[model samples]
Target: MQFLLDSADRQRLSLDARPDGALTLVFDEATGEQASVAPRTLLWYKLACTLPAKLPPAIVRDYATKTFKPAQAYGALLNTLGPCR
Candidate 1:
């Protein structure tokens, strides 16, 4: 399962992979340590960006809701960002 973030601007984008099978966040442009985020945490990042305002509020109530892990899914979300890093 991969995740893709499609916004109005395509250039300002990124790609990441969880080779170890652990959820990981890969920024399109390496921002040092800041770019690497936990697989589950990346879900939060995605939600904060795309989901409806109401959805986030509800999600906050239960921090463990539908959190996808990198291990569970291979190089997912990589294609979304374009190429792998």
Candidate 2:
């Protein structure tokens, strides 16, 4: 349920942060093991960071909450320096 972590349903989109503090939403519906809609991928590359803020007005902007991949969810997963996933 953690950010960027594999999900059972795979519906839980996992987003992470980039080097410049931006975020990269990586959620490939197709595991390459089967077919799926938007199978090619539906990535949101380099989204702006929004940490210390709760519940982003836009659902796509929210940070890791309970189990959701927050916009700035890679704050810790990055060795405290890597991308915010």
Candidate 3:
């Protein structure tokens, strides 16, 4: 998953899969800093920016009320983010 932040500097952020199969957050900066985060950790932030706000109430309610194990939630988030290149 990739994002172009809407700030004055317009930073780029993406979730990339490393050659070792580990997931990493890649920052497109001069220093090329990268970090790995647990799926549960990512869930704490509102990571679903691609979702539409106009979704139906029932769908929204279902999403909000649903429970998931850490790994499951992470898989769901990955699905929402779509496939990484």
Give the number of the best model, judged by TM-score.
Answer: 3
Q: TM-score of every model?
A: 0.28, 0.26, 0.36
Q: What digit string (tens of lDDT, one per residue) describes model 1 on residues 1-85?
A: 3334444676343334455533333445456432444434555466334523232333345433368443223224432332212
Candidate 2, residue 45: Cα displacement in angstroms equals: 12
Best candidate (score: lDDT): 3
Tens digit of per-residue lDDT, candidate 2, span 32-63: 23222121233211222223333445754543
| Candidate-wise lDDT, in order | 0.39, 0.39, 0.47
Query: How much RMSD separates candidate 1 from the native structure?
Result: 12.2
Error of 1 at 71 (Å): 17
Instruction: Score candidate 3 by TM-score against the native.
Output: 0.36
Model 2 lDDT on a 0 to 1 scale: 0.39
If the candidates were sorted by their TM-score against the true structure, best first, what order would they fall in? 3, 1, 2
Give the 10-residue window scoring lowest on summed lDDT in candidate 2.
Answer: 36-45
Candidate 3 Cα lDDT to native? 0.47
CA shift of 54, model 1, Å:
22
